[model samples]
Every structure is written in C-alpha cells, then in structure tokens.
Target chain A: MSDSVLRWTRPLAALVVIFGLWQLAGRVWTFPGYLFTPGEIARAWFASLDPETGSAVLATTLRAVAGFLIATAVALPVATVAALVRPVERILEPYIGFFFALPKISLLPLLVVWLGYSDSARITMIAVSAFFPIFVYMFAGVRGINPGYLKVASNVGASRRERFLHVVLPAVAPMAMAGVRIGVAISLIVTFAAEVVGQSPNGLGRLIQDGFSALDYDQMYAGIVMFALIGLGLDMLLRLMTRRSPGLWGEGVPA
Target chain B: MTSPSHVMSTTTVQPTALRVEEVTRTFRRKGRNVQALAPVSLSIPSGQFLTIVGPSGCGKSTLLQIMGGFDTPSTGTVTTPAGPVTGPSRDIGMVFQRATLFPWWTVEKNVAWALRCGGTGRREALQRSRELLDLVGLGGFETAYPNELSGGMQQRAALARTLSLEPSVLLMDEPFGALDAQTRELMQEELIRIRQAAGTTIVFVTHDIREAVFLGDRIVALSGSPGSIALDLAPDLPRPHTHEVMRTQEFLDAYETVWACIRDQASAREPGRSERAAEQDDQGESA
Candidate 1:
C-alpha cells in the first residue's frame, strides 16, 4: 500500500501545486469571485454531491458505464474474429477505418435526430466513440500472436477452445487493457460532449452548459473541475484493475 | 563447421518408424514453380536420432515441414505405420529454431497445456508439467512467464512443453541455432539428456555441422537445390558422448571426413572453382 502511494505521490504533489497557484492568483489579483479558488471549487464540488444534484452525477456515471460496456461487447468478439480470419480483417478494416476517420462530434446532430435528446443518444454516441480504439488495439494484439505458440498448442492436442482460453486470450489481454484504458477516458469525454450538445436533462456537461446559459462563470468552472476529477478517477481505477488482472503484469511466476 | 560423432549405440530397429517415399514439394509463386524438395526418399528406424544438415536454400526446412505435416508434399507419400500424417499429430511434437512459448503462460502452464491437450486430466497434467519443468532444471519457474526467462530458459520451457505431449517423434528445426556458443552447447547437452530420458525419436535439422554430428545417431548431409541426401553416415562412437570426447583424434578424423564432403559441395557451387578433381583422381587410382 505504501509503495502504491509512493508511486502516485508525484502526480498528487503536482495537483497540489496547481491548486495552490490558482488560489494564490485569485487572492493576489482580486479575482476571488471570478477565479473561484480551489477551496471554493472543493466546497462547491462537495455540495454538488448532495442527493438531488448527486443524481445527475450518478446518471452520467451510469451512462458512461453503459456506453463502455456496450462498446466492449461489440468490439471484443469482432476484434477476435477479425484477428483469426484474414478475410474478415481485409473486409472490415476499411469500414472501421472510415468510421474512425470521421469526427465523432459531427455525428452528434444525426445521433440526436435518430435517438432523440435522451440518455440513449448520449450513451450511443459514447459507445460509438470508444469502439474503434478498443477494436484496433485488440485486433492487432491478437493477430500479433506468434505462430509458434499455436503450432505448439496444436502439436500437443489442445482443442481449439482450449487453445483460445489458455493462450490467445491471455496473450491479447495486456494490449486490450491498454486499449480499454484509452477507451474509458474517451467514453467519459464523449459522454460529457454528448450531454453538452444534446442538452441532456442532467450530467456534468449539461451542468456546465446550464451555468454558461445563466452567465455563472464560477459554476461553469466548477463543472469543468468535476469533469477533470471524474476522468482522473476513472483512469486511475482502470490502471489499478489492469494491474490486478490475470496475465497483466509480471505478478506471479510461470507455473 | 566440424562434425562430432554420435556417441550412442542404440541402433536396433523398432519396426517402420517414419517413411518418406519420393516426397516432392513445389510452390507456385506468381506462375512459376519453385521446386523446394524434389522426389526425396528417407526412412528412420524407431528411436533413431537423424539429423539433417545442408547448405542454405537446399530445402532442408521444407522437407522437415513436410514431414511434420505442416504442408503437403506436392507428390509422393510420407507413410508412418502409426498412422497418416494429416494436419498436426499429437504423437509428433515439434520445436522450432525459435522458442515459440506463449509469452502469457507461466512456465508450468505452458507445459501443462501440452499435456492437457493430449488428454491428460487437468490436475494430473499440471502435476506432470511441474515434473517436466523439474527435469528441464526450471523446477522453481513454474509460474514464470516466458518474457522473464533468458533465451536458453525459454527454449528449455519449450522443450518441456514439447515433452509434455509424450510424443513418439520430436521434430526440431535447428532448435538451438539461435543461441550463443555456450548456451548452444548447454542446450545440445540438455537435449541429449532429455532424449535419453524420454526415448523419443528425433529428426533435427541444422546447417551447423558440429551440431549435426553431436546430436545424430546418423547424420544425413544434404546438398544444393533439388535437395537430396548426398551422404548418410552413421557415427560409431561410444554412448553418452561428452565434450571431453570432442577433443580426441577420432573426433578430428570424423570431422575432417564430413568437412571434406561439405567443403567439396560448397566449392562446387562457385564459378571457376578449382578442383579436388585431381585429388579424387589420385585417390581413385590409389583405390
């Protein structure tokens, strides 16, 4: 536990320094009302977590989770099948590439038109945005498995399922986890963006939009600050989860 | 560059082990036929260690690949009384020049995977894998990933995995060809020890003459394109050949004999090659 804390000390210290500078600037420049120091943001952030306002954060978190889960469900099997079959890769890669090339924000209007200004549209956008990175990373990782390992497995009499369960999945997990980590950050960002564009009933993005409409700069800053915290928290959670996953890091010995 | 005599004397035939009759392979590359192996014939008695050594581009690997049933011979038959070699056989294990261990599996799991695939129960297979690891001097590394091991250790894990299948014949394509000198020597010794313990027939291929000589009961020296066996020489040496035997006159004499044939082939490939034709002429006359 101490070791893990040490590992994060530098980043935590940097966070402190940034907040300290922001607070100092607010006090020195007589910009207290507008600048809204770290203390003010902290107070506001905690207050925003009150049962009524907290529901919005909860709704946004659920949306992000649903979007990411859907993306994972779609991407993993597609990536695995694509990796195993050359023809599938040749057929699907161009279309996937085309989708990835498009500006995700450009699809916001179409998504709202199709799914309406509800949670569905926001979640759908998030899923679509996160899908490509996970797919591409996982596909490459699976396809890059050394043929020698397969031959060894085949020569030994491993059924196809056994080979997949014991070898292929494990080999691809680290690369896939990296993609998942990236996708998690992307999904959160896209969810926030979707909420802002679609004018969803509640979310950090919607909250920020509402503050902007009311000309409440401090509230807008507070929403942005919360957004950053949520993103950081999710990423740290993923890193911890990956570190614990089997076949992830060099945790146990070979046997 | 030199040949070491095969020191083992278990040459008793154990029926038809492996048979290759007029096996030919050709690859169609953009409308041209590249004959890799042309109408080759060979056989190995059960339990004999036959090493194939040849010049580059001689299709030594192509032949081995065919024998392992990775690719079909364009023509002819590879008949083993045990059964037909279709795809890959659980009875025939293989180790490549590169150790192809799954980087994700722990050393023990990798070995156990082989056994489990060969129909051993999970618990028993895993236990057997541990024993195999112990045999390979990796007893304590059962849970260690391939990435953590040195090249030699990774290859050892590969050997253990191959052995876990309890294969009748183990096909190795220059398994230690990628290692440094010391590691190569250690691996060669390790292979000999493992083979002795397991009693698996081995068909190992290499370009290194010394390795071919060191490991083989009979060394098949193959020559250039349209690869065919140029010489089939049995090494009549004492059992359990050690490094000490490598320094003896008998070893030097055997090395010289093999090198003469290999060097002769090497020179013959070059244009304006000066002959040992005169030497052959004199030797022929003396004979």
Candidate 2:
C-alpha cells in the first residue's frame, strides 16, 4: 500500500474494531436504556433533525458565538492596555488572578439572579468564562515580544501608533489566536452548561434536559452528539481562517 | 579688496554630522553602581565610515546606544548638525547584531514597512523596497520570509530596511558578527560599497580588527571595564578597497597594531603570573 493509505488504515481499523465491540456488548449484556447502542444513537441523531431541534441548535450556536465576540471585544483592548502600562497591570493583577482562580460555574446562579432568567444571563456566564483565557494569553503575547523588535521600531523613528499597529499587533496575533481558540471551546461549554443549570427557555442543553424528563434517551444522546459536532466544526473553521491568512497570525498553520 | 561674495564664500562652513561629547553610562545593579561606559568623545564628519572595536564588557554597545539616542548618557551629550539628540530621531538609523526583521513579513514587506513607518505612501514604499532589495543583491527573493533566508541574506535585508529610512547616519552593532567567516568578509565589502553609494556617516561596532581595518576610514579602539577610547587612528589605505588591499603590507601593519592593542589590554586585566599559570595548566589538562 502507499504511505498515505497506510497512514489512514490504522485509525480506520481501530474505529471499526471499537464499533464491533460496542455492537457485540449491546447484544450480549442487558444495558440500561440510557446507555444506547451506537446504531440506535445514529438513527436517533438523524430523527432529531426536525425544525424544533434545528432552531434549538441555532439558538445555542448564536449564544456561544455572541458571548465569544463580546469577550474578545472587551478583553483584547483591556489586555493590550494592561500589558503596555505597568500601573494598570499592577492594579488589575490581583483581581485578575482572583477571578481566574474562581470557578466560573459557581457564578452562574449569581449571574442568573442579576440578569434574570434570560439569554443575557447565559451569555454573561459564557463571556465571563471565556474572558480570562483570552486576556491572559494576549497579555503574555504582548509581553513576550522580542525586545529587539521594539528597539528596531524606536531606531527607525516609528511613532507610538505605528509601533502598536505594525510591531505589537503582528507579533502578538498568533498567541492571541491560540487563546481565542481555547476561548471558543470554553464559550460553547459554558453556554450549554448555563442553559442546563439555569433552565433557559431554548437551547440544546434545554432539549437534552427535556428529553431526560420525557424518558427520550435517544434524543438526549442526539443532543450531545450535536454539541460535540458544533464545537469541532467551529474549531476547524478557526484553524482554516488562521491557515488562510498566515501573515496576520505569523504562524502559518495549526499543528 | 575682496568683494562681499568672496567674504560670504570664505565664512561658509559645514557642521559635523555626529559628535559624542564626553558621554558616560552607569547602571545600578543589585544596589551597586556599575559604570558601563566611561567618558568618551568622538566627532564624525559627514560621509565617513568610523568603526569602533573593543573586547567584551567594554560597553561598546552602551556607547552606540547612547549615540543612537536609545539610551541617555549620564554626564554628556550626543550632538548632530541639528542639535543635541534627546531621543531617537528620524535622521539616525540602527542595525542590530541580529537581523531584527519581522518574521511575519516577506523580505519586500519588511523593507517596505520601515519606509511606511517613516511616512511614505504604500505604493511608493513597496517600489523603493524592491529597488533596495536589488541593491542588496536579494532581487528575486523579495517574497521569501526572514526565516527562509540564510543569515547573510537576512542581514542584507536588515541593512536594506535601515537604508529605507534615508537616515543621515547609520549605527550598526556587529551586523555580520553571526555570519560565517566567508560571508562576513563578503558583507564587509558590500557594506563599503553601500557606504560609498549612500554617502551616510556610519558608526559600526565590532570586535574584529580586520573588519575595523577593512571598512573604516578611522578606527577607534576602546578598552577596560568602564570603556574609554584607547587608540584612535586612521589607516592609510587606498579607496575602493578589495581583497588585494587586505593582502598588502600596509593593511597587515594596521591590523597588527589593532590586534596588539587589544591583546595588551586583555593581558593587563589578567591576574598575577602564578594564577595565570594555574589556569593554563587546568586548560592543558582538560585539552
């Protein structure tokens, strides 16, 4: 076989073996209804493709994306300012560390109470959760720029704005993108978790909860599969964007 | 009697391009004051290439930084024809020991970015960048990234970027020090050519005596911990120097003089004879 074919064969074989074992176990053992067979789960996943579930998926995706955008818009400029000014960094350091250390889920009840039982509450939770990772990574990126680049800028008589645009932005973009990738995953997870815990009116998390209450095990499994797919799809989309514009990020492709 | 026009002609004078007036730099480290560069002074006329040579820890870099207005001297000033330099100005450009090109930019973009920062329009900057790349012998590699090029090529690109600013003075700190011996020699010749073409006053810092001799119109040898100029001599060499010029007796004598000065300074800092002997014995056993 060719090298390319051989490279893919091993992973394919392992997946096939695992599915076979799962089917065999389903036949041999008396498993709980909630513990679904792979075939049954696949069938349920296709069956859940109605207008209602599709809207639920859209609702959840929109919330996650909005929350991520909000976090980026707020955190990036704040982190840039903090990184540039020592006094601001000193003031924010302790509080930033404290909030980052605090479990984001623990604040979900307070957020719901403050913002009421609306989409705002869930978004607030997701935004707060996503903010720390992106902010910290961006701060580190700005601080970690090679000092020589700044020297070159100064020597060439680059103005303050020019230095920020040309030197600082390009240098920190790759690291900031790394943080954004993690933030995207975090935003999705926190949005879904907040939906389930807060009992929001619409979303995949609510659908899953409704399925459990209605004894629709298949529907719950389908909801989970959709969640995983959405996260994976968004991450891949981000990776593709980074690859397309290698100059902006400095690193050409994700490893 | 002389006419009024004759009097005006006689009175006209050109100001010095760069002047370092008794500059000194001291740093505070671990609650102790450390003198980095002692009082040193030099004047560079316009369109001259002056090279500064010294051993490690002699504060050559500190002095260069001071002259470039990146760092302020403790007790002296660096004056150009305009006035005393308070900070980094557009008229002076610096090239570091390593190529400080932005890795994200292609070779053409790197040079163009410097021009853009200096207030040139985008299209004109790019056109100028292409011309500079050709001048630096990197005509076809404009699209290549900094990491894609060899050390010599990267440094050449860096030189092109610095030149893009059209500065009156160029301050280079060991620009080709990281290259191989052959590449360094080639770069040295290329630099002389560029200097002649551009007619910018250059203050180049290096530890290599031959490099100092090859490129400099005047060579300044600095010595000691808190560095000061030990010797300042102009080598009597012909213009448009070549490899054959390096082989001549005059070049050898000048190289020997610089080498002896550095060697004597190194030995002067050595400990007593018994300690030196013991250190040599340890090295002998290790070898």
Q: Candidate 1 has which clashing residue pairs, if any? A: A253-B143, A253-B144, A254-B106, A254-B107, A254-B142, A254-B143, A254-B144, A255-B142, A255-B143
Which RMSD values do the candidates have, in order? 7.3, 6.5
Q: Which lDDT value does model 1 have at B110? A: 77
List runs of model 1 lying over 4 Å from the truth: A1-8, A14-40, A249-255, B1-12, B29-32, B267-287
Interface RMSD (Cα, Å) for model 2: 2.7
Q: B1-287 in candidate 1: lDDT tens per residue?
A: 01122233354435556889999877764687767677899988777889998866567877887788777888988867776677678677788878887765677877887887778899998999999999988989998877788889988999888888777678898888779999999888888888788777799999888888878878888775567777888867555677676777766666676777877877777555335643432222111
Question: DockQ of each candidate's interface versus the true one?
Answer: 0.37, 0.43
The true-versus-predicted C-alpha distance at residue A9 of model 2, in Å, is 8.0
TM-score of each: 0.87, 0.87
lDDT by residue (A171-246, candidate 2, tens digit) is: 8988899899999999999988989997788999999999989999988999999999899999999888877654
- The true-structure Cα RMSD of candidate 1 reads 7.3
Per-residue alpha-carbon lDDT of candidate 2 for residues B123-212, written as tens digits (9 for 90 to 100)? 999999999999988999999988788999999999999989878789998999899999998999998777767767789999888899
Candidate 2 lDDT at A5 equals: 98
For model 1, the docking class works out as acceptable
Quote the positional error of residue B19 for candidate 2 in Å: 0.5
